[model samples]
Target: MSMPQPERLHLDSDAATGYPNSPLPVLVYRQVLDISNAEERADAFESMFKRHGWPPAWRYHLYDFDHFHSTAHEALGIFRGQARARLGGPNGQELMLYPGDVLVLPAGVGHASLEADDDFCMVGAYPPDQKPEIERGDPAQLAAAKARVAAVALPEDSPAGGSLAELWREDS
Candidate 1:
């Protein structure tokens, strides 16, 4: 088998180029269950969503053995213990996600990680309505946002480029 390449730069908003333009593009997220006995995990997972205002309306998938790259947006959350994502090579980028830690997926982003050291669970956050795709920014930009903007929006799907549109954003 040929070696998979490590993309030094993650492609996020660029995925839109592959699809026909849309007024409102579909955004995606996921809810990961704790790694435990299947039956118990399933039950608890169901209950957790209920506590939220959610009604199990969205489509989703469960991962058991094989790691899959989602066509949909993905973020990481840990339910039980420490969870770490190992980027295939020395790409100098690895998301060190912990319990309650959230990793937002940009438009065309992909990820793969080894098994969890403890039970891992997370609820991925994405917009149901059309939203501008967003990705992690460079050091200067990230620092500036934290310093200045109460909240900054990164445009990916929206009909804008390079930055967030404050008027277009909703309450987080």
Candidate 2:
């Protein structure tokens, strides 16, 4: 089967939220899941990420307020239900994600769950051996967050397994 092309968005820094969104664009892949069972879907997504060098995948619901990871990039794959999320800080764009959707968040990009159904669940992963440092719109961490974001290395490819290297390389 052919992979769906991802929708890309580039977010700017929000001074008020103190979020320095990445220069790398966030990539969203829609309808990527083949399994109907939530647990199975999560397992498949986690395996995919692990195969592609992203490890330590976890499954959970997203938080309902603005937050970001300053230390590492993240990939989230929706396994069940639907949700509306705000990306790129408080002033960021709101996007609706459903089961079978995948979102790739670069380091320093902000994200929060605005709303979701009771069954909402997703599988999240980071690059191999990397642990994400959570930052919640703190002005005190702005400078260091920005620096960490700027210094983060790009992933070799997309978590969904495609030509993200070229996509991200050109964007970077």
- After superposing candidate 1 on the true structure, give the runs of residues whose Cα lies further than 4 Å from its correct spot: 1-71, 87-92, 129-172
> Per-residue CA lDDT of candidate 1, range 6-110, in tens?
112332221222221111122222234435554454444444443432222222222322221222333333344455553312232355544422244433332
**Alpha-carbon TM-score of each model against the true structure:** 0.35, 0.94
- TM-score of model 1 vs. true structure: 0.35
User: What global local distance difference test value does model 2 have?
Assistant: 0.86
Top candidate (TM-score): 2
Q: How close is candidate 2 to the true structure, as a TM-score?
A: 0.94
- Candidates' C-alpha lDDT: 0.32, 0.86
**Worst 10 contiguous positions by lDDT, candidate 2:** 163-172
lDDT string, candidate 2, 1-172, tens digits:
6778888899988878799888788999999887888889988898888877787468899999888998888999999989999999899999999998989998999999999999899999998656788788777778888998887777787888876677675354
